[model samples]
Target: MIIQLHGRRHLLDVDLDIDIEEFTSHVLFGPSGSGKTTLLRVLAGLDPLDEGELRVDGKVWTQGSAIKVPARKRDIGLLFQDHALFPNMSVEENVAYGIPRAKRGDKRGIIQWALTQARAQGFTSRPVASLSGGEAQRIAFARALARQPRMLLLDEPLSALDTPTRESLRNDLRLLIHTSGIPTISVTHDRTEALVLADQVVVLINGTVHQIAHPSTVFEQPADAQVAAAVGVETASAGSIVRRTNGLAEVEVEGARVFAPEPSFSTNGVLVCVRAEDIALAKEQSVTSQRNQLMGVVTRISPHGSLMRVDIDAGWNIASFITRTALDELELRQGSTVVAAFKAPSVHLIPHD
Candidate 1:
């Protein structure tokens, strides 16, 4: 099934235009209140579009001129952030709720399949209140899948759980979605989750779709400063393309000139972006294979799980993540002067708006 959306939700101030493909998943990613859930509701026909249209496999659900179908008639599977399970209903009955009237005759068999698919069949007769958070989540997923809808909508499906459970459930959810061959649109504030589950990623911010691209492309080459921050690219500096020659461009930031591969657009008033992992640090200036090197003083040191994040002020702030052992051996700390080096290809230049 294919989904095409072209409309504006005035309350959220978001205009939508997207073509979701068959057997693929797209992640709508942003921070809280970015309108991710509102867009999902629009797709499920729960929210009205003030203008434009929405089509599923060529069947019109809504248009600027008319509302073609109601929410009940739209075959959509939606799993809310809270799961929205029936507290009074048993596991079997909750799954059966999503099944249409035509499928009611074989509801028992279908519900069983859904429960098994979601790994919730073991609690088939359990009351909703008795199930654990993860168990409830599985039941909710089972209920959504019971409808065999044209598409699936998920709103922060695992955000309510703790770290370990969330990680485990994320894996299970990915496996189930892949196994069932359902087209899905999942909303999340976590970029890592978006990276894990998305075939295509739509970066939304301030009720607008900022950038839409493949995960690798979005992570490596963000469309703008907002996108850079959204994808966790923090080592960014404002500059202009001072010069361009031989497929390379020189960007001047905070009195220092840096070189990077030229971008498609002219890079005047641009932001030079590089990931923390791409930078290497040394106590003294040295040149090996790295294309660019600059000296700076360590401004901050923080622990990031197993790695140590070191921030250097090379005229401007540049961050590097290195092993704790290496940091100790190098005798690096706040106020220590060091050299930060990275390849020209590692720097991505985006035109500043």
Candidate 2:
């Protein structure tokens, strides 16, 4: 299905166009209050487009001041962050809620199939309140799938769980979404969630569509400083292209030169973007295949989840993530001198205005 939407609603000023192929997933990704959920609601026909139009498969669902189709008729399977199950209902009953009364018997097999596909079949007879968070979410997913809607809409479906539960469910959710053979549009503010679930990512920021591309492209080669900041590209330094040879460009950032694959756009000045996780640190100038190595003093060390973020002032500021074990082994401390090394391809340059 071809979906096109151009409109303004609340804080959202969106112009979105995409094709929904079978078994594909598109993620709307951004920070909080960026209108990701707003756009999803618009597509689901819950929020009318205040000033424009939304067309699905060339059929108008909303135009100017009217919603041609109501939310109930959209045939969309929606899964919310909270999993909104009925506490009094058994897992089986919750999954059967959307089926028509006349056809409930005919759809029983489908309910069982969905429960099996979601890995929630074992607990079908249990009350919703008795299920764990992960199990409850699985039941919710089964309920969404049981209806066999044309497309699925997930609004931060896994965000409410604890870290371990959320991480474990990520893979399961992706697998089930694909297994259902339904195109999906999911909204997420978490970067890793977008990376894990998105075939295409629409990067929204402050009510505008900043960049729309694959997850890798959105994270690695952000279109502008706004996108770079939003996607957590930790190191960005303004640099000038000093030379171009054999498709590689030499960029000078604060008197330090680094080789990078030439950017597609022709610009003398570019923003050098390096992900902290892509950098490697060494106490000495070790001989390795990495093309860029700059020596500097470690200015700060901060805990980042299971790793430490080591900030180095190597002409320009550079951040490298190392495990706690490596941190202890390397003896990295504030004011420790170290060499930061990273591959040439790891440097993504955005054209500077």
- Pick the lDDT winner: 2
Candidate 1 structure quality by residue, lDDT tens digits, 11-39: 44554556666337889998788888877
TM-score of each: 0.93, 0.95
Shift in Å, residue 71, candidate 2: 1.1
- Looking at candidate 1, what is the lDDT of residue 187? 96
* Alpha-carbon RMSD to native, per candidate: 2.0, 1.7
Candidate 2 error regions (>4 Å): 100-103
The residue pairs that clash in candidate 1, if any, are none
Backbone clashes (count) for model 2: 0
Error of 2 at 45 (Å): 1.2
lDDT at 153, model 2:
93
